[model samples]
Target: MAKVLSLILGGGKGTRLYPLTQSRSKPAVPFGGKFRLVDIPISNCINSGFRQIYILTQFNSASLHTHINTTYKFDNFSKGFIEILAAEQTFEHDSWYEGTADAVRKNFQHYASLEPDYYLILSGDQLYKMDLESFLDEHIKNGADVSIASTPVTRRAANDLGIVKIDETGKIIEFHEKPGPDKDISDLKIPPSQSDGSDKEYLASMGIYIFNASAMEEGLDNKDSDFGKQIIPSMISTKNVHAYTYKGYWEDIGKISDFFDATLNLATPVPQFNLYDEENPIYTKQRDLPPSKINSCTINSSLATEGSIITDSYISNSVIGIRTIIDSGATLDGVYCMGADRYETLAEKEENRRRGIPNIGIGSGSIIKGAIIDKDVRIGSACRIGVDKMDRKDGSYENYHIIDGIIVIPKKTVIPDGTII
Candidate 1:
């Protein structure tokens, strides 16, 4: 196996995921409660036996920097290591990276110094498990100058991505960046005559590419900007560009809806993304905390990490991160709570607000449901939360009452004793 130089692009201004991306970069968004989004690709690289890696970042990358330093560490004796390349200004180039290709172009001299054989370019915001060793082996066997990982996508979804056309020999002949109407799909290469008459519109690039060192260098030098729009299309005519078929669970978390959908999917009974593969473990910073202590709680299909304490609460289908505390008489469904401090503030505010008697009364009859609570919440005894009128119609008032749809209780609000909220 050749020593591959991996460049993970982490510098996207995540405007779609506002508020969450407001504080950190998209790659640094908290995922599965505990891990960050960048952990997926970095861990994939480590598990795939490729240790020489560099992460490139631009916007609000402090959290991303801290995560990489705290989570991934390599021995000095080993050749395997990870480096973070933040944007720097030089006399010739004083501006931040404009596009994917420009980011690489700026770092070309740095990469050239390393003397690597192949360059593996990857996006940091995608979610999937890939063994690059297999992809690289296929690239070598095909004698391809550039090999891109591709998957079958529906025609409707193809418009969002750079669509490619490949011929019978598995050679990519044309590349279209977000095709427009009247663009001939037929001219877009398809395999030889198929058994079915249906249009064989298969194989869209996964935005993952393996480039020969020389090809990458040439493309970086020739193109002014934009890898997908300019450089890739230019190389298609001259180089042996090929598509490597990939069949796996992959997603591009580009927007808030996409991020939300991906997070919610992890709560399923049998999630599509498996993080428990011991052979290819998703490594993260290990917080030294005790296992979650659940006492008399009704929890169903939820993921609770270390240092969680759930007592007399009803929780279902949620991801609870480290050091979270769910008090007795609380009900939660479909929520993602990260960190303890934020949870505590919300709990206190709700406890005080529900009492109506201000600081002197307890919220004994409160109920809560379908809400995300952050850490360190101090709830008064007997608060009613998330309980519905229908639940009370049966003459059973054991559950807390729900106030409205999507109400979040900030952490650390105080409540008095013996009040029905």
Candidate 2:
């Protein structure tokens, strides 16, 4: 059996996912009520038998480190290990990771000790369940130096992702990184023979790759900062680069709008990304909390995770995360309430009242629509958010923000009574 070292790029500043990434790293950001964003790739790696895994993170990694240390613990005899390789200022290199390739290149000294046969590169903020054994098999079967996972996507999505043009033999010929709407990428359309009768016109790189040991070392020999922008394009001409077409559900939860939509979509009867798969389950840090308790609440097409208390509320098309507390007469629609980290004690509630602030969670008679209430927010009674003000400008405010026309309440913010946003 060939040894494959999996490297998950935990992303750069994550400016696109700001506010949420304000206190925590992108990978550490909570998702789908219970699990974090990083859990998707880590679960996929473990399920695919890729035992030795390393996550490369640069910014705001404290929570990520704590979560990893608590959740994934191997037995004393097992060789499997999941570790975080944080960027550090060494004597030789004094700067933080400049880009994706730079992050990996700098960590070469650490991972090189493992001396694996192949390197499996993955993006941290993507949602998908892939059988990487099959991916590695394709790379070995093609006898290619590097294999990039590609998914069929339309022109609208092709603009934001790395577009690849492959020949009939699955050899990648050209690569384009985020060729915006103005670019003429007609030549990059998927070949009819490889289209598999799909309406998607282009094949976009999933930022997932399998590189032979020598090919990776050679590809990173230069000062190329990014894999898609610099290394992959350069290697296509000199190396045996192939494309592995993957026809499955894949979502890049990078932008605020993308994150919001992808999350609420899971509140439906059937989501595009399945979290209830029996065999390939997504893992996370298990909090041994009690079951959610609802009191005469009419919940329709919503996912209320563990340890929530809802009373006389009308929730529709929403995701109420763990440890949530919704007071009586509250109506939540198309909302993603991330829930509190810890339940506020009675003393804490008294302190909040003393400070003239609401307790942690939704107060009575509050109506929130198309909004994201972050963790540990104290929303007072009779508060209306995103319901009345549909055309709110895109900017930050005292307690919340409106980005892409969606209201976002940052972590631990406080909104007083009778407030309307």
The local lDDT score (0 to 100) that residue 252 gets in candidate 1 is 85
The digit string of per-residue lDDT tens for model 1 on 35-131 reads: 8899888888888788999999999899899989888889988788888999999877889989888998888767788888999999888899999
**Candidate 2 root-mean-square deviation in Å:** 1.0
Estimate, for each residue in 310-404, the C-alpha lDDT of model 2 and write its tens digit.
99999999999999999999999999999999998999889988989999899999999989989999899999998883569999998888888
Best of the candidates, lDDT: 2
> Superposing all C-alpha atoms, what RMSD in Å does each candidate have to the true structure?
6.8, 1.0
